[model samples]
Target: MASREGSLSVVIPAFNEAGNIGDLVIETIDAVPASLLREIVVVDDCSDDGTEDVLKRLSVTIPALRYVRHGARAGQSAALRTGVRTATAPLIATMDGDGQNDPRDILKLLAALEAPSGETVVLAGGVRTQRR
Candidate 1:
């Protein structure tokens, strides 16, 4: 197990994903251990739907949940960059908001990074074989 120093931040970039955002947020919160998670930052790319409202409500319920809405519609990459820029944690873990990525994989990635090894690994990630 890795040390729970509140060092990791989860950044989710969403665009018009009102239907999936709330569940994803709740699932992400539940998947990550409280001690290891510093915060969860959701960057909304000017979603026309109710994603902003959902995030606002979730933020009130989850202390670690923070969100930012772009003034204009930006693509997913731009949303990710914005989230990364706004994140406060040194270690950032990014995931899609459309529920394509598994929240539990975050722990696996963290464990892989923390594992002792003679050779350095630059990154650890899982492939998404099935799209929802």
Candidate 2:
């Protein structure tokens, strides 16, 4: 079963998430199956809040982490574009940097993608329920 499901690429775009990037990376690493995850790309959009620094520091701990540096502060779309272009994996995943989304949810998406007869499906994230 593991051999059938292809690799996954997770793209995390950050502008000023120095305080959250470390934890987020750790949680994301722990959340997904190591065999399924190809890489985790964190695109730094010229963040002034030391996000790039945080990512560099994190690379020491997270081996799967890859950093993409931007010259200036670009919007999320630009960051995402950079990430997607740089990613080598066929399955690309994206998430926000505010720490609101749970990394564990990635498993659900991966499972759904592995479902029989489910191909060429683009998963767009939608928040319609509250945990409370």
Candidate 3:
């Protein structure tokens, strides 16, 4: 059991996810409770597919949404690093920008943590079955 309750931040590393980023962010926001959600940070790896514009438009309606862009193209690791560093919440949940991750699982993952024990939950992986 987690000893202390803290807000959550969702981080996404994106390259060319303009078509998917909007729906992903909206789904994530809907899944997380407003009280527990700190913010959702989307890090753009210098995508040329207008991902930045998508995020910019979404931010107007959702105050909890924030985004950062890399001046040059970087890998996923660098984008993840940027998102984590930009996140303001103590607890951060990372997912793919392509919307493969289900936001509904965020609470379940948080429930599995034991923050007071000085323990860290590094990777929580899931399998995707019956791909269409």
Candidate 4:
């Protein structure tokens, strides 16, 4: 089994999350095993909230950060599919960009994937706290 330090890709779907993208990226980086997931792809669904601008600014500093925009405004699922298809890593992880999911739990999910049972599993975490 490969350690969590192996290469991994994180895909985030954004739809008007100009306010959350930056912080989300930072938290995701902090949560992932540094040696494992150095690349993150943020797929925007043709957001009109200046998300493109934020990403443009971020790309300058975050070397592993990648921003992909839908030629037309596609839904979240489409954006997710795009990000996954474009990912360069053998393993891919996804998280919501609405500030609802905790990035710190990423490691736990990765650990689940490495379980010794040798069975395929999909790990999902639900938030009990409400955003309202």
Best by TM-score: 1
Candidate 3 ranges beyond 4 A from true positions = 1-6, 114-132
lDDT of all predictions: 0.89, 0.83, 0.87, 0.82
lDDT of 4 by residue, 1-132 (tens): 235455788899999999988889888878876688858999999999988888879889887889999989889999999999989987788887787778776777667766588877666454546552
Worst 10-residue stretch by lDDT in candidate 3? Answer: 123-132
Error of 4 at 56 (Å): 1.3
What are the runs in model 1 whose C-alpha is more than 4 Å off?
Answer: 1-4
The order of the candidates by lDDT, greatest first, is 1, 3, 2, 4
Model 1: colliding residue pairs = none
Cα error, candidate 4, residue 33 (Å) = 2.2
Per-model TM against the reference: 0.92, 0.87, 0.85, 0.86
TM-score of 4: 0.86
Better of 2 and 4 by lDDT: 2
lDDT of 1 at 44: 94
- Estimate, for each residue in 13-129, the C-alpha lDDT of model 3 and write its tens digit: 999999999999999989988888889999999999999999999999999998899999889999999999999988889989998888888877776674667888665555655
- Ten residues in sequence with the least summed lDDT for candidate 4: 123-132
* Cα-based lDDT at residue 17, candidate 4: 92
Between candidates 1 and 4, name the one with more favorable TM-score.
1
What's the distance in Å from true for residue 105, model 4? 0.9
lDDT of 2: 0.83
Task: List model 1 lDDT by residue over 5-71, tens digit each.
Answer: 7888999999999999999989998999888888999999999999999999988889999889899
Give lDDT: candidate 1, residue 89: 81
